[model samples]
Target: MQKIGILGGGQLGRMLLQAAANYPVETYVLENDEQAPAAHLCHHFTKGDIKDYDAVYNFGRRLDALTIEIENVNVDALEALEKEGITVIPRPAVLRTIRNKALQKNYYTTHQIPTSEYILTHNIQELSEQTHFFPAVHKIAEGGYDGRGVQIIETEKDLSKGFDTLSVLEKMVNVEKEIALMIAISQTGEIAIYPPVQMVFDKALNLLDFQLCPAELPERTYWKAEAIALATVKNFNSPGIFAVELFVTPDGDVLVNETAPRVHNSGHHTIEAHYSSQFDMVWRILLNYPLGSTEAIMPSVMLNILGSEGHSGPACYEGLNEMLKIENAFFHLYGKKQTKPGRKMGHVTVISQERADLLYKANKIKHGLSVITKADGRSG
Candidate 1:
């Protein structure tokens, strides 16, 4: 069996390992926590920091191929591994560009990809000088993910909220709708694109609240999104699955928002709704197998299960029984033992033929299920 190692051991890694069961591959995970979500699922688990050059280098040298659950890993080590002939999915160069917000934006501009205009700043003083760029979004160049490391600078007064480190100040688009397209590319230059999905974020938390697959879009807008997403991934020129988040402006123009170079939350509903899940697609790419179908078996809505406010301790699920009784609902808990406010604990996917049914069930689950701490004796 071919051996593969994954960096980081969060829920993404856990789900990836779950999908690895069907393939003739031995899996390994390197993480700092011994009880990480993916630790027990893999054949081998090494407790080490994914950002440490030596730890990542040593762990990957023994594997036939390597991939990542998160982008904040040691890229230098991945570059070294690629030199040693161990396959690194998506290529280290791609990660280097995507991991930094400034570099990612510059790449978009350089490649002529449709994206919001942005200005790079090295520090707060540099940002203050660009007051005319107010009402923009300030994103730290590196180390930002899942709603963190981003702030909205509505005016000069809000500039203090901007990062003191290198960052990107992007002109916010007049967004009409947010969409995500998942694509998978193979080593031979073949590509497969999943239907674009409509995403709705929890504005307060800046995290994805729920998303509907096969997003309803005007024909022209849908085609535009598809073409732009394909171009973005094609330029990466690497073999791996990618999630391209985009914005649909009021004028019906589609612009690139960001891209994730691995299995993403936006495509999580694929586990039960599509012929080939994102997790399965990643495995196929890693193994050099023919790309699987991205066709949906049914229309679906995925709701994120987040920790309740004022809860922090051992995790507890309230109203889970009620949710379990609902038809066409699939629940996936990440096996995380602790609960903190706004933490992503699990997700529920509801699939149905009718859009009305999908929306009704999704709303019910959104308000019904709650992740809270057993110590608090309260549910959100």
Candidate 2:
């Protein structure tokens, strides 16, 4: 069996482990946490920080090929691994570009990809004097995820509240809807694209609240989103999954929002709804195998279950059985140790032929569900 190495061991790594089962391949996952989700499933679980050069270098040194579930890992190690005769899918150069938000935006500018207008902010005074100051979004150049490290500068009050840290300020364009295209590039330079999915965010933090696949978008916008996504992959010369997120502007234009160089939250719906899941896609792509057909097996709506306010401990799920009673509602729990406010604990994917109806049904059950607590003594 061919052995491959995986960096990071959150749910994406865990899901990849599940998918690699079909090929009966031996897998190794390097993770900082011993309680990481993929620990037991992988043939070898090396406990090490992904951002440490020695850890990443040692893991890649022994594998046939290496891939990552997250981009925050040490890129220098990937570059070293590339030099040490290890295959680093999607290429370290691409990962390095996407790892930092500033570098990512610069790549788009260089490639002539359409995106929202942005200005890099180095200090508080600089952020204050910006022309597009009001109603702009503030995003850190690195280490931001799941509603953290991002701020919408709707008012002067927001900027004064400590949201101005190493931020990139951009015009908050009018968006009709938020959408994402989950794409895969194989080592042989083959590509596979999943149907675009419309995302519904929690108004407060911009955290993904729910997503419906095959976004109810016009044919033109659909093709445009796909084109932008493909263009990004081509430019990167990557050989792994790329999740290209976009915004459908109110004026019927699809604008590139951002990109993830690895398995992403936007593509989580593919697990139950697609012919090939992202996990399987990643494994196959890393092995230089033929990519799977990126067809939607069923209409699906996925809901992200975030920890409610005033909660900060292990995850507690409610109404999971209730959702399961409704035909094909599948719940995925990301065995996280804490459930702090806005933390991603897990997600529930409700699949059915009648997508609209299923969405409403799932919403109802989701309302009954609470990853939160009702003044419980134990943190949920």
Candidate number achieving the greatest lDDT relative to the actual structure: 1
For each candidate, what is the lDDT? 0.93, 0.83
Q: List TM-score per model, in order.
A: 0.98, 0.95
List clashing residue pairs in candidate 2: 90-239
lDDT over C-alpha atoms for residue 338 of model 2: 64
User: In model 2, what is the error at residue 331, expressed in angstroms?
Assistant: 1.4
The CA lDDT at 214 in model 2 is 78
What residue runs in model 2 are displaced by over 4 Å at the alpha carbon?
A: 162-165, 373-380
> What residue runs in model 1 are displaced by over 4 Å at the alpha carbon?
376-380
Q: For residues 1-380, could you state the per-residue lDDT of candidate 2 as single tens digits? A: 88898898888888888888888688999998888878878989999999999999988898889988888899999999899888898699998888788889889999999988998887777787874557888888888876677777887767664345566787898989999998898888888899999998888877887889879998888888889888977899768898998989988888788898888898888988998988889877877678988899988898877777876666666666666677678788877766778777788888888976877866876686777654553543
Among all windows of 10 consecutive residues in model 1, the one with the lowest summed lDDT is: 371-380
